[model samples]
Target: MIAAISENDIKKLKEDLKQKGYKLTPQRRAIVDTIIAGKGSHLTAEEIYDEVKKLCPEIGLATVYRTIILLEEIGLIYKLELNDGCSRYELANKDEVHRHHHLVCNKCGSVIEVQDDLLENLETEIEKKYNFKIKDHSVKFFGLCSECRKDG
Candidate 1:
């Protein structure tokens, strides 16, 4: 909850934008800060805009949408679609070779991030049998979380 965006992170992001012929404007920085601060929450565009607006009252919703697209394109963030109406986003960790999976509680609609890959052996077997290289994979499980199970 106490997530802090380091200056190095902002600098790196600025450099990434520079390569794409963009600059880290104040509004974009505020958006990035909001996303970085709430990295694990998997915020939607509207939620991000709401948070960013507190810091930048002049920011617009369309600007948040555009910035989200640009950040995702630059690999600074990852988009997550839960088959719901809205899309969510989380900051992309620079050191992550493979993204983590999510466990969604059907009863409560709560999502828990599973940090382990847990599919190395399966991926290896499939790659060897199919003669195809694996790039990345996402796995989501729908079930009752502990709290929901207890409540039930």
Candidate 2:
């Protein structure tokens, strides 16, 4: 299914890419369309490749990787490196704000977002105590999800 991303969003993305000296090619546009269609935040490069292939079978994996890297550099998406040694991606925007930490189900490999103001405070305290500046951080908590635990 084709995802619904606003025309304004596409135009803005193209402007952003042009600012960074990148062109909005048809392949990259199709990839963005697939990402826009998806519901969840987590997506793998292979997943993107599969979706884009429907529109452009001639597109290559390397091109997808390169496009993802470029998009990441412009802060259009966040690259998530899970403990399982694979990278996933999600769009970053004001509405779908980035959160700290995740509740991951080990058995089912599901990821749920966890919001913790305490974690933000702790990071601030650490930075103050050490007289150091913190830019960004990532955290993950792994265990059985409620359903998995109940099923066990």
Whole-model lDDT values for every prediction = 0.89, 0.81
Which portions of model 1 miss their true places by more than 4 Å?
none
lDDT of 1 by residue, 106-144 (tens): 877788998888999999999999999998888889889
lDDT for each residue of candidate 2 in 37-96, tens digit (9 for 90 to 100): 764668899998988898999999999999989988887787887677789987665353
lDDT of 2 at 49: 93
TM-score of each: 0.93, 0.85
Clashing pairs in 2: 3-37
Model 2 scores a TM of 0.85
